[model samples]
Target: MSTDGKSPLPPMDWPDFQPGWVWLTGAGPGDPGLLTLHGLNALRQADVIVYDALVDERLLGWARTGALIEYAGKRGGKPSPKQRDISLRLVELARSGKRVLRLKGGDPFVFGRGGEEALSLVEAGVPFRIIPGVTAGVGGLAYAGIPVTHRDVNQSVTFLTGHDQNGLAPDRIDWDAIGRGSPVIVMYMAMKHLDQIAAKLIASGRNAAEPVAIVCNASLPDQQVLETTLSRAAADVAASGLTPPALVVVGGVVPLRQALDWRDGLADASVLDAIGRRTRDAG
Candidate 1:
């Protein structure tokens, strides 16, 4: 663990991540410990850290003092800095010959708009490197004791965004195909539109009784997991009233959460019982 702002700047293994370029790195699903070694190296060496709303700020403490930190996060329905501006800023920073770190929550490439930013940097002739982190769909589910791939429950899994920034199920995605083809589904940023998303899945042949677990603030101390069935997910989540930056898992593996969940323990048995009893009731 490198101390915040004190290193004499040791030699780096990846010469490609040197100054004069931007590194788009994922900060993991909310836990600083889950940060990749490459991501941590970037944080320590960065001349600036341009981060998202979901990123854990504590991770910024790793950056050297006097490092410029920019907030570029955009939440759904909230006034936010435009994506074009954020991309332009990255180009500017690299053009200024600074070691830029574009820190994002979860995996940068996984719905983090990293591809857009990278494209902009490339078009501007700015050299860049990508450091992948643990995406929330997998890490968040693990924290909630939900395995994305279980031989008994599902041989395949599908990942989808709950809604587009416009607050509608993405028209670009074939929900019917995803619903019928994928045995397991993991959703990101879906809390607000879970009801509509659930309905679409059910209409597409997903069983209303399928188990669902919403893991909020995954991998963090304040994390909360809500367990419910597909038919009840929308209402139960609405009633709980948890905030965003959550991951939702829907499939038979949700039931395994009762036994496999090790993080945060079972003192909150309600989350576990919700799945078991709900499954029985539906049966």
Candidate 2:
């Protein structure tokens, strides 16, 4: 077994990356190790790879020699291609007899827009395969010692995006219901409107003092976790200068970090505060 990042696999009965077909694969959060075997296989065989903004570029090194690389990533508040254009590009590449690979961060279908691209492939009659990867909501939280669901803390979890295409809080989501019903909530792309979203939840009856943890650059070497209350989440994030590409989780589970955090560094100051509060409460 190779101890290094390269994966020139010892041959197996792997499916062929046929010309005129696209494989939509997930690269996982930010850790290259989180990549699935099937995703790695697709990489070594694809003639061309179209990747997203969040995808770790290091994964590209595993691609076949001379394989073409194309960037199709979209970041909020930046000039980016239209989703339609990206989908069409996949079709164009596949139809041109290239072994196409559409790579994304996290699970392709889990809010990664893999479904929309798949539909485009379908409409174009291009064959494709899906290789699922660990989503940041689950895997990212795990690295930060926050469980999305636990028998002792929560039976239901809600995963949501903080903003819609217009870059504002989503109006269609019944925030009131989610605030009350979901014992654990994981939010993607939420840092931008953290304060507004927190207020909405509080207004919807969620406790202002509920524990909330923001995991930044999750699963990466520079990963940082900030633990605070719903009321303090926005303020703490601002004061700490935490940025996007982060996951926000709200629940009683957030306090469990005291016992669960196993990373090399000490837990954040806010996390220590949470532990003291919990200890006092238990006493």
lDDT by candidate, in order shown: 0.86, 0.88
In model 1, what lDDT does residue 75 have?
88
* lDDT tens digits, residue span 103-203, model 1: 99999999999999999999999999999999999988888888898775578999989887577877788989998888788999889888888998899
Output the number of the lDDT-best candidate: 2
- lDDT by residue (1-283, candidate 2, tens digit) is 2224564567777777889889999999989989998888888888999999988999998888889999999999999999999999999999899999999999999989999999999998999999999999999898888778867677789999999978898889998999878888899999999999999999988888888999999988889999899999999999999888999998888887876777755455566666656633422
TM-score, prediction 2: 0.91
Best by TM-score: 2
Q: Model 1 scores what on Cα lDDT? A: 0.86
Candidate 1 error regions (>4 Å): 1-16, 267-283
Q: Which pairs of residues have clashing backbones in candidate 1? A: none
Cα shift from native, residue 167, model 2 (Å): 1.4
> Which residues of candidate 2, in runs, are more than 4 Å off?
1-12, 265-283
Per-residue lDDT of 73 in model 1: 92
